[model samples]
Target: MKHADIKMAAEALFNERHNPLGAFSLGSETHRAVTIPDAVRRCRWIAVDINASAFGLFFVSPSPERARLVPCFDSDYPGVAVSTKFISGSNGEEMVHHTRDSTEPRWWTDDGSAAMNAMFGKLAWTGPMAPLAPGTSGIAFPVHADRGQCGLVVFTGSEIILKQDLLYEVHARCFSLFAAVARIRPSDAGRAHTISKRELECLKLTANGHTSEQIARTLKLSVHTANQYLTQSTQKLNAVNRNQAVAKALRLGLID
Candidate 1:
């Protein structure tokens, strides 16, 4: 498929109005499920990983060799070293398997198995393994639908060779699409505002009437970084200045 066509398809896949829990169902219903082959045919990758935590959902294609996911736990493989937590939800667990060197094929080793169990919790449900052939690589993108539920679409194979910049762009677009879908609120619900941790810190200091320079010093960042955070918060809040940014942030419950 052409690059533009792939992008359009990806946007439509992610932007569907169904709840996050329905991604897997959509995959089954649509007849054109997103998978490793799809990713490689359209983009480039040997494998992929997608997951969601309370902080936010992310889909990372061409993830590190050892990366994996468990939908039931809403977690990733070898959970020990990672800093994120799983988002609580009811979707059954899913896992994506990939290889760095497909020609010299190797299945999941003991370490890999152990890591999967540890990250997903012993009792979590597991999904089927998607294999990659020789000379290929893969990428996984996580899609967060709603209610802390999520799903993954993995792309793999050696057919498409991708550059780092292109891969990053693809994943960035994927994340943006996922976020847009995830932000839709139910009519009767009181939606919670979200700001990245950095944005929250900046807003808190701004609310205290700290100058950008002062906030930067306190946060151990350059004034430019502090200003950038404020700017982002202002944009997120649709506000005009530091004071308005803080007020709007508070009103939106973006910061405690």
Candidate 2:
């Protein structure tokens, strides 16, 4: 699809009032949605997993399961632990929690990290999904706004082989729409304690290579107060220093 066409389609997908499950439920009663096949015909399977809690499944040409919602933390899937961390990274989050031995011997013994790197690389390149094997691929793209709740889109298929360009286009379009949605949604509801809006502003400026003095001047705060905010934010985010804190805040959506 042309860039303009992709942009239009993404806008439509983002505006469509669907459930948190994502594009997989396009035709369902919950929300007016867009069917994945209409956008990318070559896709054989589609699944969307969000926040490592909910997952929506879709298959265009059929597979083991036509469609389902599976829990992400289920231990039934051996390699899911490593894969989940990659997903967290893709969504710009730092650190993922997994139990000890969540890494299986059989799975880790067979070049698992290399495989994970390859898979995450493709996810970075192709969007958020990886092939179950050659010719069989899946894609999951996160959906969220700049200051809103987050979700995802997932697609998987085994019948049709997708082109590299088309895959890249799909990935980019999905992420763009996801970001738009994030802007419109409310801030995450479960946040226990958030950095004050002032603190976030300071961190965002700092992340853009601003000095504490610059940030303080920009925010109309004294240098000492600016430094205090930075130190407090860094501690809350568990960052080692100002630079690391800035990076972590951005990654955690604690700042712009």
Candidate 3:
């Protein structure tokens, strides 16, 4: 999409934010579990809406002095590793340097300012360096978590359109999305917690598309018992639904 199309869509979204009966309810649904597929869909939708060619959600290590960029969900480049002192960096590369030496022309909000226009206006891309893409231009929303941990949700395209109101709306949505993902994310030390043996069995069965009755038949248990196990597994996984529970289990390697 062209920059003008991007600008027009952003402006519409910005205006919709103020509509009392607006249908955009992403910010209010953060309490739900966010599966990998769900996140990817949201990112893709946002990218298309804003005319971005790529979208990524990255976890920035809490250690500012030796920060690491862990790509959680990237449309263009998944699992790319990079390092930066995000707290002190002034330019793109200093802030976030990709492994292939791609320099990201980005805007930092670690300073706690919600004024995106002011922050964006300060960006100065000087000197010769590889763009994040062929002609990368994007916005990064920094999401701060507990204990100083943080992450970034970014949108990039060959030509990106930015408006202060639109950026603010996107930032709020990014924060909500990040929180939903964090709930299902495994602990830094590895698996956040464990499910019971029965719970695991039920979750695996669910992943295989087994209904409660089928699971009960397979396990030679009552349907009520099978459902109980599935419910317990869902609760233990911190998921809002069976599909989410199955997805989380698969991600944590608890089930194939």
Best by TM-score: 3
**Candidate 2 regions with alpha-carbon error over 4 angstroms:** 1-150, 156-193
Which has the better lDDT: candidate 2, or candidate 3? 3
Question: Could you tell me the TM-score of candidate 3?
Answer: 0.46
* True-vs-predicted CA distance for residue 34, candidate 1, Å: 39
Candidate 1 global TM-score: 0.27
The alpha-carbon deviation from the true structure for residue 152 of candidate 1, after best TM-score superposition, in angstroms, is: 30
Give one digit per residue, the lDDT tens place, for model 3 in 57-120: 7664332233345556677434442322222223333434331132223443232334533546
Q: State in Å the error of residue 211, model 2.
A: 1.0
Judging by lDDT, tell me the better candidate of 1 and 3.
3
Candidate 1 segments whose C-alpha is farther than 4 A from its true place: 1-194
Question: TM-scores of all models?
Answer: 0.27, 0.32, 0.46
Candidate 3 pairs with clashing backbones = none
User: For candidate 2, lDDT tens digit of each residue in 162-182?
Assistant: 344444444444444334333
Worst 10 residues of 3 by lDDT: 81-90
